[model samples]
Target: MSSTAHEAPPWLRPRAAYVHIPFCAHKCGYCDFASLAGADHLADRYLDALERETAAKLGEPHEVDTIFIGGGTPTRLEAPALERLARMVAHWLPLAEGGEWTVEANPGTLDAAKADVLAAAGVNRVSLGAQSFQPRLLAALERNHAPEEVGRAVAIVRDRFPRWSLDLIFGVPGSNIDDWKADLDATLALDPSHLSCYGLVYEKGTALWKQLQRGEVEPVVEDVEREMYELVMDRLEQAGLHLYEISNYARPGHESRHNLVYWANDAYWGLGLGAAEYVEGTRTVNTRDMQAYLKRIEAGESATGPNERLGPEERARETAMLMLRRTILGIDRADFRLRTGYDLDTLLGPVIVRFVGEGLLEDDGRRVRLTHEGRFLADRVLCEVV
Candidate 1:
């Protein structure tokens, strides 16, 4: 696990790369990503700067195991622009054999031309942002796409890609258990290979958060939200998808390898506006301001905004926190020690024993994982662990 003076550490040799696209056709009310709405004029310019930044970061083409292009709807770009973006990424970051290249798309923005462009660019996986199957819930979330658009998008993705994933949101304001059940049923009918079901979060400064404050929206009660999550676990598991992470489910062999790099706290390369990269125990994020990122790249300056270099102890604790998010394979004691150079018992023995007594975690001496009941209070458990 340790490296010699002349050798490069394993964490420094990242196999995953993430590229951020910051243009969205319509910015959702609840979103806080570093994306711009009605910024179509800047699309080409953004890609121009992205090309420069990628070239600067990667002087020579680097092969990676997973490459994810995510953002304010990567599909929002015109077909030609999309093709340029894809080609640029492929040029700078060639894929390793059997590597997974994924693109995030919105149902409203995807079309046959765009889908074909992605497929032709070596994109083997597509994760469609099908937030919900219910019209009312979609409207409540300020989603521009109609419920029917999801099916059409899925059909296009299925035809071109080997495997695809769908994202669903529960606990939307005014939603109930029946509505959640209906959404689950509709999602299963799509026969998606992967699913990410998340609870709606009303982050501060978002339109939805303001509505909650002004009494314009009635947020889902905590108990109801918990019930919706439990239902998702039950329904998805019964449908043959394994709960790989707390919010992510996938059929065997279809799990998101790109995201798994994150849950395992492995190093990765993040490029473009507001993207964050971690390598050699240091994490740096590009500026969230699009113009700032462009100017920095144009001036041949660092686009990094804020960064931190974690010491050994900080990294070990963080590694534990992230690894615990994997519901099925939690933390392997031997692997943890190998990766972090820290003994699991010396770091978190007391915390583990306490939570295990509370029936929130299970430690069979070899692996440590959250139990079924522990998942409901995972956030609380994780907070205490860290």
Candidate 2:
């Protein structure tokens, strides 16, 4: 939609916030986030700077609908430090009643004290980074936690929180369909309300990427990866965790509200190093450098690195691309025009017609969504639309 003269457009109400915690015990082989290992000493300083940055940006109290504290393992902070961070969230975040407050944590590192701190801070959901249950696959993925730790964390979260999610990885170097099945089964056994299954991506500059280049580690073939993804869909559905987003499965009412804000192309606020925000047709990201981010926030300077103001066409295209990722909540043509003042068919008529004719999309006049075949070839179809 067009940006009005209002400083914060009413059309883009701020309902979501993402807080980044970039401290970790170690970096994984396949990781490239703005995380620093052996940086526990920086937590106190980072938190102090983060509070300043948050206060500077918030301007006034915002009744946030969802708050996600993601990380390089937020639990890596010591108990008192974690409590301090949680207190910051509780103090400034102003989470709405029964709002979703989620914390992303590593399995083994989340001790009882940390869990207690998060629970006390009103964090109602915990997303555990339990990539896989197999020890061999875990070692190959450079995960330090044992399989048993996942179960322990799940038990603790179950007792402390009302909802939780598990993140599982498939298409590992040596993993097969059966191994994936085993992992899915193990995850279901933990009784999580949500599950996010992702294929292993060998990003450039990661240790895994280098290993692939050096022929030290082989990635799962594309065909195998597709099969594993299909398996995840089938197994999660059978286990009652229905597919919501492409890579996320949730029991009814357990969907990740914060992430859906991005998929729905809505506004959000992000704080701390490397965090991204989209508010009122504009997008910006904080500096990825830890020291720079801290210094900038502490010095009362802008920490945002890249900034862009998206025009109407740009917003519509982005919204279409993102909303199309939803398995069930397809794009509504009438609502689309109301939101963006653009005819959906005019914007993507040719692309949609081409894919729909090819049995990739189902456009029933009112709404448009991917067919099963389209979902299988999502990348190709999305390329056509975007």
Candidate 3:
């Protein structure tokens, strides 16, 4: 499963690409992405390295179905720099006709000019980082935007782009039911095609984690968080948004096609610092160090990190776990058999029966899916299945 000198492209052509832009105006208190603040000076070098990595991984003129430019905060780039990066993608790995091109933007950074540039450059989708609408909650999270800025950003995006989404965070320590409901109401008022809601997590080495150690903030109780989650689901569904993934809801046709590639366990190429890719049965990631990534590109070197090659059995297990995340794409018994050369019924017979009996799973002859309660504990269920 090693990459040969010839760069062994797998039998299946990659339908997706994820480009990382690791620059932010300021990092959030709970952030751990490979992003930095006060690093705009490295923009030129990083773009050069990104283009090189793009060329090396995808080669020239390949047509991919979807392209996602995620961040630190992609909107932090100036209009000209953003245009350059977009044009490079168009020139190198041209997207398919009607392909989805999504860029992650922060509300504070996404100006109308930059939004227009992205639209003109064939970016059809924009995902805004409007984590919260409450100013006090945002201050606690160390986010910079005011509540008004989110509406303005959404207006600009809706006016300029063909499709757009908003990313929201809930379950913050100081946030109450009223605050959470208010955020949801504000978000729905904007009428975004897609919405992603995430529960706040305290990762080690993050500022939020440090605050917890210093007794500055407390973790939200699990029961309260679960209640908030239920409220979110009920509200969003009432507004006609379908819950596509655990944390994602979208209008019927507005689901993120690029993200679905990952959830479906398909191959993709990831370019830029700290980007990860899964191809040819191996998962590969680029170096997280920005300077090292740039230097290697300058020296015409590949900036790949450690690689993991999965055997057939391992790949099947991985695929099952990922596919189960999508509510619509239930696990097909026969397709699973063909892909893994293992019978799902035989391999997970006891586990499936137990879950089904407990009302955690539903088996409909040819496939299986998570029940409502099962969706909440999907992580634990996935662990059991895998």
How many clashing residue pairs are found in candidate 3? 0
TM-scores of all predicted structures: 0.97, 0.96, 0.95
lDDT scores in order: 0.91, 0.87, 0.86
Give the lDDT ranking, best first. Answer: 1, 2, 3
* Selected candidate, larger TM-score, 1 vs 2: 1
Where's the lowest-lDDT run of ten residues in candidate 1?
Answer: 1-10
lDDT (tens digit, per residue) of candidate 1 on 1-386: 21113235446667789999988988787898888899889999999999999888877777788999999889999999999999999888888779999999999999999999999999999999999889999999998999999999999999999989999999999899999999999999999889998999999998899998999999899999999988999988999999999999999999999999998898899999999999778999999998888899999998997679998988999999999999988999998999999999999999999999999999998999999999999999889877
Q: For model 2, how does the per-residue alpha-carbon lDDT over 85-186 read when each residue is reduced to its tens digit? A: 988887777787779999999998998889998999899999999999999999999988999999998888888999999999898999999999899889
- Which scores better on TM-score, 2 or 3? 2
Kindly report which residue pairs in candidate 1 clash with one another: none
Please name the candidate that would achieve the greatest lDDT relative to the true structure: 1
lDDT of 3 at 310: 89
* Residue range 1-386, candidate 3, lDDT tens digits: 21223333321347678899999998899998999999999898889888887777665566777999998998899999999999998777677778999999998999989998999999999999999999999998899889999988988988888899999999887989999999999998998779999999898999999999999898888888999999988999999998888889999999999988887777888888899988777788988888898999888888888899988877887777887787766678887776667788777788889989988888898888888898888888899978
Which sections of candidate 2 miss by over 4 Å? Answer: 1-11
lDDT of 1: 0.91
Give the count of colliding residue pairs in each prediction: 0, 0, 0
How close is each model in CA RMSD to the real structure? Answer: 2.8, 3.0, 3.2
